[model samples]
Target chain A: MRRSAFRRSRGDAPFRLASTGAGVVLLAIMAAIGVFLVVKAIPALQANTSNFLTEKIWNPNAVEPAFGIGALAFGTVLSSFLALVIATPVAIGVALFISHYAPRRLAAVLGYVVDLLAAVPSVVYGLWGVVFLVPFMRGPSEFLNTYFAWIPIFGGDQVVGKSMLTASIVLAIMILPIIAAISREVFLQAPKTQEEAALALGATRWEMIRMSVLPFGRPGVISAAMLGLGRAMGETIAVALILPATFGISFEILGPNGNSIAANIANGFGEATAVGRGALIASGLVLFLITLVVNMAARLVIARRKEFARAA
Target chain B: MTTVQTGIQPISTGRRVKDRIVQMLVYLAFAIAVVPLLSVLWLVVKNGIGRFDLEFLTHSMRNIGARDAGGGAYHAIIGTLEQVLLASLIAVPIGLLTAVYLVEYGPGGRLARWISFFVDVMTGVPSVVSGLFVLAFWVLALGMPFSGFAGAMALSILMMPVVVRSAEEMLRLVPNDLREAAYALGVPKWRTIVKVVLPTAFTGILTGVMLAVARVAGETAPLLLTVFFTDSINNDPFNGPQMGLPLYVFDQAGRPTDTAIDRAWTGALTLILIVMLLNLVARLIAWWRSPAKRGS
Candidate 1:
């Protein structure tokens, strides 16, 4: 609003100071989290017998206390990447359908459905994944293994459902709504004049979208995918409930082997000792860093897009 | 070559076929997306409806065993409400003031940019990591006992960003003309915000706050470490461990027996219903408050 008279008043200083204090509280909280995690994680790192990054074993509670994040980090990256690969195209397609292809009423209903899917708690997804999806996925896992055995990741003899593939699928479902919602917003915001120009030419519907909408939404799609990737990497309850926890890092996605940092912490923390709790906190720091990098990268992408759009 | 020589050319068979195929693919994609959601809701309702009754809502699982039949989520319901209310009490004021600062005083300022960036980063922080932070700080370093208060603190960390972002959007939507009018009448900026700007954005702020509450109420990872999941009722959140619906569902689902699994499904159903109710109310309030704001 136009606050010319208010701006001329002398009382603006105190209000500004009060709001700045509130803003500083947020900064303080973020700083405290980083400092606390580092301070608490140091002693456990000092006590470790194995290399914290490269070793594959986790034994923080043992007398010797050998521990590493090799397997957990591997599984976290692998499943999250797989989830992004599976969810990105489908989410983009659904976003396109809702924004362009569907009729108005249907689009509204579908959008609400997607929002409801997002509202479902992670624990509920965990319950559904464990109760229904795990057993249901066995047949598909077996089929994939039987048909695609030439592929290394699908060649494992044990085609048990509770494997990396299963966890990735669950993560895909968990993240689909977020990607769809974000991209839908982006797609809906495409310039109408550009779409009309493409259509006023002799272009088909799909051609119009490709020429006008897709190019406009490219940066948005990237940031949305990154957001989904961040969530998949840090998701705790669903992956914990589904993936049969294992410490081995193998390429066989169909094999019964997987572990993520957040899942490991959630599964192991209840009965942990002092060092074990510290070790989990140390791993949590790693998780925080990964998420932070991903989120910052996404924001960088968005900020660059805004500069380009403004310049253009 | 013969078809597109003129300005108003006829549509070709090849182009028509491509359009049909792409349209079919889009429809197929939509169907594929909806399948998992439908199946999850169907299964929860199918399995949980049998146990979702008055007895289940009223009684507690105090004396129930793996084989026993009768139990309820009365204690968990109370615990979830108390913890969520406490967390909202802590988060809403800070979040609102920060948002007010961003919109009213520091739009595009250096500190505002930094604050907004960290808030976005905070939004992506995992629920379990927040739990770990609280465990490391409150329970471990400070030697505080595990209780619902600790869980509320962790949940506040998660809820504050949601409230800030949503409330910021709402505050930005308030018209500049209104503020200008107040200023023209010789009113101070703070009074204008308190008397005029806030009232205009109150319903929007309420919706945002309620949505944040819904989200944190369903968070189990934080409570797993903080509240620690008791079976019996604990009235005081400051003194003792408390039962929450999400934690109860997780604990029940971990059991090996069929009855326990059944209860887990029922608990999941209850949690979903609670979240759905809050979401519906939030949406309803938004819709009721702004009937003219459509589509966007």
Candidate 2:
């Protein structure tokens, strides 16, 4: 090796610099992306003070430049909420079954299947939703609306085929794999000795899980849910395929609530005018921050519980 | 006698009814989870199988609506291979080198700790965000036109973290005694790493690389922003639009015609098959190279 006269003495400084440099480069890239997005989006945000963050109008044909996020943000959160409510319980149960109850071979098969789902491309899921699934949701949506129309959230929507319900179901399908994988891992990591002690006391299988395993795993499951939430909030193609891009605030799960941050970005980005593109960038920045917060929150919840457990 | 029999039978019947309900629910849940997965696969096999003919696999994209209809995805397949292979080349070395640095040098130092921690943070970055980062840095700022190289760069960004983490674990498994023996023999650090340490962890490193490739192969967003698709094949990476299997799926599904929709299903299946093959190869390599299997 050629002698580096510069680092011949310390020998460690070069490697240290490289390592620290790599770390800084990674951080700098993330920070720079955030800053650039904000800087680029400033113009679009300036043009529409009232509509940029809150208004639901999205008509480019109008003489005035009319655009708003009220509908988009509502759609984003509602679909995510629907996905969370549906996936969380199923994920928890599947995790429980795999880690606690199922036969070893069966559990392995289940795990493989779920992980396989994660590998499915987003566009494929979207196609499946449009071609195979949305048509079926019509009957279900009507059935729910028939009895539960009195409830604001279940009220009838325009176009029974392409509604928030279709989008939400697709989102749920995508997030389930992630949530299940995390929860299964958490369940597996529950203090083995604690579980053994419960079983030794002749606690039935279900009761043992209820008492000893669950409390320790509660934080982990919550973290898993949060991760799933992050994914649901940002999922684009599947939602884009199914949702009608109607801009308004509607509580109905089966109704149009415009399009999500991601769906709107994907839908409008290709054809967007210069100002329109910047607005989409601004919206993208919002989505990015939301996901970042969700991720950090999940990490904090997991980290804090570990700290508390140690202290106790 | 009849009244007693009736009373006993009613109670048993109710208990059986409750048991059946629980059993049915369990099956329903399993079925619910499996339906989407299987139906998607079924669609792919049914539609994609016809498209998987030899000519289709080997040929380039045909012109639009000229009825030359049988050209293969050869260009796309070649592009995917080259990009992913290039990414693997970039990623494996850097990742393995960094991993070695951590394992060999770090006992409990601050620098090592930071590298380890930042890696975790990097792991949480969503794939789309990573795509945007590549776009901002490489395409927008550098004035590099979108190409296969850009897609490879994005893949490298995703591939690096996974490789670093997995290789670190693998390298750490090499016993300290091995290093001590090398030191006693007066072997230099770099020589010891190459001659003694790497041989032991080669299998694991290979596994990590294959998994990384599997991950990046199916990515759509990075390609969407960096190397957008072209209908006709361009073998060159530096100049023009290149197709990938994921992008093919996206293009087909986005249009939603009968023929296009069928093509999307086929592409999805093909992508899945490629991933499965890579995983299988990794597993086989790991098994074959394992010390116990070799009777080492």
Candidate 3:
């Protein structure tokens, strides 16, 4: 290694400089995003009459210039959590089917279909959600509100179709392809020998999958879910189009009250005052932080899996 | 051996039933997963194909009334093409270089690890947040007018990480034997990469970059905030507000008129077709240029 280093080519310097500059540019962009958000948000935070974290009212345009992100954060977390709940099992099932059960041709076709679904843009999804899903969900929302009224999330009297439940369902559809694609790749990577051993032990196909495939795919599925959660939390258009924006916080998802940070920023940015824009940026800062944590968690899981693979 | 043959007994009916049920569930899962995708495509095509004519592709919405049934998305298509081209121009090179560094120069270094981590984080940053970043820095701080270039800055942010991630994967797939062969011939390291490694991975890198472009080209949030909408065609991207396909769809949909609603559907169809076409081309390149395809 030392000898090779001593004999380094003269052309190395410029190439190395260019590549390192590119890498540093990525780091600098991330830092710059953080710094600029903070710098711009300072005045918005100071000019506020109420707590930026606790107040529920958004009146950045008023004489007092008061606002808070409590409701938006709640709605964002609640809706994304629900989306993760809805998407994870379905994604796992689809992944398992593709990796293990489907015929070869069918698996290939289904894989392509999922890739197409991912390629379908978010605005298009928002269009479909508003035109079809909003009306389609009205019946179900009413049913849940009527029959499942014992639950707090379904206890609301009003059954607005454009509610948190509706937004979450849209988010679920948006994230499903990503989680399914990642988990399918992971499941397909499970050791063939282990699967054969399980089958040789007279295990049924389901039992064999349970023993050989799912255990290996667990970490991958967790990371996929985290990634999906990140996507759902940051999703803007679909939620903006579907959810009826209300500043009031409500535990009842079946009611007409839900607003994510991204959705709020998109919906309200047009009519905002200068301070309102800053407050929106501050909300975006929160969104950036949330997604950053979720993505880092996913990366940590993937890193651990790599280490485990190396050890094995 | 004859005695061992009797050890094999017929499987229980319960096990058979379980297997059948599991297999059925698998099929059901596939159907559930596919139904929404097909429905979306179906609805878009069914409603949008009416106005997808040459006139729709060539005329701008400059003076047309919202209720008047005759304007098209020509300006939007032009704006989208220019902005996406600018974004690709800015992002692809930086992304490819960063990927080269990660794969070739900074394999296990601390900076490499940090870069990889931040890129992951960047991957999940909301599109609106990227728009906000640019709005604060470029539009407000630097005093640049809202233009397609400003929108390109945000789009580049979103595109770069995607390009880096995919390009890194493609670069890593270039076998070490090729690099070793180049070095054995006394070629410089940089030449080995540019001539041998890059060429070998060129098709895969192209597909990755194309996919990245497709992903960002459909983005509406960044353009909505940065490029602020315009109705007329603007040849200059660096000067004023520009209309993009996604933003055009959004603006049309928000109008309370039937004609505008129809235009929204058509605009969406155009955008989806552009994106899907990019994806299909990428897939075709991957299929045709795969090393295994040559052997087969």
Best candidate (score: lDDT): 3
lDDT of 1 by residue, B146-254 (tens): 8989999999999988998888889988999999898778888888988999999999999999999999989988898788878788889998889899988888888
Clashes of 2: 1
Per-residue lDDT of model 3, residues B46-77, tens digit only: 88999999889999999998679979999999
At residue A56, what lDDT does model 2 achieve?
84
Q: Which stretches of candidate 3 lie over 4 Å from their true place?
A: A1-8, A307-312, B1-6
For each candidate, the DockQ is 0.68, 0.26, 0.70
Candidate 2 per-residue lDDT, tens place, A1-312, comes to: 334542253434565555445555555655776886787667767765466777887643233556777788888998899889988887776777677767887887778787777767777788778877888888988888888888887876453867888888888888888787877777787889988998777555565677887887888888888878988887776787788877778777776555787788767755666567567767777787888888777766866654321110
lDDT, candidate 3, at A156: 77
Q: How much is B191 displaced in model 3, in angstroms?
A: 1.8
Judged by DockQ cut-offs, is candidate 3 incorrect, acceptable, medium or high? Answer: medium
lDDT of each: 0.88, 0.73, 0.88
lDDT minimum window of 10 residues, candidate 3 chain B: B1-10
Q: Give candidate 1 misplaced runs (Cα > 4 Å).
A: A1-14, A305-312, B1-10, B291-296
- Clashing residue pairs for model 1: A1-B176
What's candidate 1's DockQ score? 0.68
Q: For model 1, what is the error of residue A45's alpha carbon versus the real structure, in angstroms, after optimal superposition?
A: 1.1
Candidate 3 residue pairs in backbone clash: none
* Residue A29, model 2: Cα distance from true site in angstroms: 3.0
**TM-score against native, each model:** 0.95, 0.85, 0.96
Query: What TM-score does candidate 2 reach?
Result: 0.85
